[model samples]
Target: MKRIAILGSSGGNLYNLGGKEPLKLLGEIETQASSAGIKIAAIQFIGAKASMDNANESTLSRLYTWNSSEENIVFSEEKALKEVNGEAKKVDSIIAKMIEDGKVQGLVLMSSDPEGVNNLSIKAAAKKDIPIVGTGGTSMATIQSMGGKVIATSGTTGTTNRTRAVAAIQSLSRHWGLKYKPVISSSGKSSQNLDENIFQRISFRGIMMAAIPGFIAMSIVLALSKIPGLAKLNDAFDLLIKGLPVVVAAIAANQVSGLDEVGIVAGVVAGMLSIDGGLIGGLIGGILAGILAFYLIQLALRWNFPGTTANIVAGGLSGLISGLIVFFLISPIALSLGNGIRYIIELALNYNSIVAGAIAGLLIWPAIIGGVYHAAILPIVLLEMEKTGASFLGAIDMTGLVMVSAGITLANIIYPKQKSESAIAVPGFLINIAFGTFVEASYPFMFSDRLIFIGAILSAALSGVFVGIFNVKGTAYVPSVTAPALSNNALGFTISMIIALVSSFLITLFANKISRNKRNKEA
Candidate 1:
């Protein structure tokens, strides 16, 4: 079971701001958590004495009751000074210990007072890579600013604390693969804004969420099929690989549809019909179908149609409309687009592999930092993989993106500007080399110093030249250590990674030396 700790001030804010009884809100959270297979391992209350004294009597009584009766709930109370400056330290220490003991996997934060619960606990959790779900304006904004594996249940402003709390549980439940109906307020309204932009509704994070499961399934099946006893599973592996588009479409549509069942049905139908257009068509069709179904369901509801009737109308109309549109209008266009891009890339490779590789390597870091890599480059890479089962661009990603990150982070460990910097660098380097997926591990160092960033991109370009000259191409988004074996030219891939690592490392060392000298001069 997943374990979590709830940390925040008392319940006075909930009742005051949202007109919600604290006990009732907690009950809703408990029900959602139970459905999601999550356990509330601990709850630590932190607030100034005045706030604690002002807390709802029913809420305090229930907390005492839970502490008295529940074996699973570890409860603690920390009373801070009236100024609230030291409110989070005691709670942070408790959480840090719990994290060290592996008793906590996630955090739930609720605090309306910005000054009461500072970044102490947040930094503690972020350092250990624990996911945090925050409710209340101050808590949500703090988590978002820190930017590591955090979820804000509502926008930082304009939402009631109770709404955020309810939404937080729902988000957590959905994240853990459970279907919990959204909590509707007594006013017959939903927390979600129906008029939110379509583009904003289509989440890149959700798209990645769609891609990861299929990728993992294919990876596991492919690996297992190589065993002698599992040779028959090769057909199953192939089927999974070929059906990737459908899986991506279904999940993407579900996310775009706000997890509506009707939207998911529409997505599946659209995905099936758009199979001829490959992953791009499926993705586009799924998003379109979800949008159509979402609005249709809302319209039906507005007209006061019966729930079942609304679902049937939305699902039937969306499925038919999206499927036909994809098949007749979108498929041919998507196919042609994919083919044309593939042809241009192939031409570049033929004309001068080194130049193509260098250009791609040099530009990739900018794309990623600018947050355009997913929308601009990922589709091209996916299309390349669908058609050829291998991609030169994928090779560049492994060397330029993944290996370069390992190098930059490792340099920070070896030549850190401070001991604290080195302490963080150690985990970043290990995570980069071991998992090879989290390029953001190097962000601390990259964002701190411009020299390091420049060195990284230059080293990546050089490494790309190595791969291009040796014609190395293979799978992407795997550990760099294993990437060589998967490549067409293992020796070439290995050399490319080495070039990326060593060049960036040496450049970082030089950059650090210059920075220290400048600091000394200023002093």
Candidate 2:
């Protein structure tokens, strides 16, 4: 059979080898198995005391060389031990004896330690033309430099590559009869971001420039949260809902001028109408307005209302009723939380943006599926004010109004095309509802038709730009459709939301048409 030998040099004293170190021995054994067509006959020398359970021993084990039957296998010397060249020579001598005994076919080295036992082992292995397999601590970088076969453990420091490698190997093992296991390891995280301290050191300008820190943050969350607890919380749907109201409201409010006022009034009224809302007027407004809009649209559609007619009725009626409640009831609560935008901003700045983003992404998908509009994102934002101060809510409110304005504008562009024909489930209506209730619902539709979603993202980003540029602020805990009433340059937020909505809706319609055309052609 294929017979190859590995000389393993570890940091631990050469006394007792068992458990994890055996696995390294097993690794070489398997390599030998591939070289020859037989099972491993002997394991002559392994780091006896290399405790995989302990760091010191493990470190020592990885840094020395051992030999079996004239084959010298090397493990890299730890940088800390580089000064101890004499002690390293003793380990190399032990490796040479095993090789001379003809116990193995070829020698394998685990790493390159220039001045220690590992270096000597390499020299010995080369003299005999023994195939040497070597790897380093940084497998990707070191393997490339050394031009040797490299295998690293999953969840290691270089997590992305390690994950990719594990996935590839697992897939290969499943499809073929190959079994590949990792030799290095860390806690089972697929990826990690910069340390907290490093992240904290970034300039405010850098944070702003990295505008979509959400992008990187979301990706990291996706990677790490593979397990149940972390995954569910870090889910994209959850992130989407966190800031959905501010985002959607900012887009929808501008569809019709009165709507923003109506939204604000609704917020105020909802706050006063219910004891809970009165306690947190802005958040209550977002929820009530969402619920009101949802029921109104459903009722109008059920009554055989025309599309355009239904939208106008739904938008006006919902906004007006909600506004009245908010103006009288919620206004008092908002007065205490913050007199104006300044209060909301100062109080709410401490809310976790990453968590908010994750919640928003997570909720977007389900909301779309469930036909809930953009209301899902409101609560998280409303709560954010409590975390930051009270002024954060005001900012959230202004943002929401801007989003609504954008949504309305988008609806106007797309609705006209599909107005005459009824769809089983209207795309914009579905997206709106999903955003309000189950934000995750947005993903399916977006993924199903990427062409449409890309347009939506671009529009939304443009709207976000306006938000950034205009520095719009509101006076409530959550967004109000009436942001135009509160801010100086709210028109930009309104216009951008319109752009996003129109783009989203139109793309959906276009995608649907294209899909239908292709299906018909195929049929």
**Best candidate according to TM-score:** 1
Compute the lDDT of residue 176 as modeled in candidate 2.
35
The per-model lDDT (C-alpha) reads 0.66, 0.38
TM-score of 1: 0.61
The Cα error of candidate 2 at residue 382, in Å, is 2.3
Runs of candidate 2 exceeding 4 Å displacement: 1-380, 383-444, 474-481, 486-489
TM-score of each: 0.61, 0.25
Candidate 1 positional error at 88, Å? 38
Model 2 residue 360 lDDT score: 32
RMSD of 1: 17.0
> Candidate 1 on 1-523: residue-level lDDT in tens?
7777776654344444332334434444454455456776665544333344365322322221124245333323432243233434555566567776778777776553333443555565667787777655545675666764664343323233333444565556656665544332322224443336455778755685458546645655655666689898878877875687676677667677653456677788878887877777788878887787767765654454434455665666776688778889998897788789899989999999999999989998998899877776766666666654556877887788888888888888888877688888888788778866678888888889999999989998999899889987755566777767656677998999899999989998898889888988999
Candidate 2 structure lDDT: 0.38
State each candidate's clash count: 0, 131
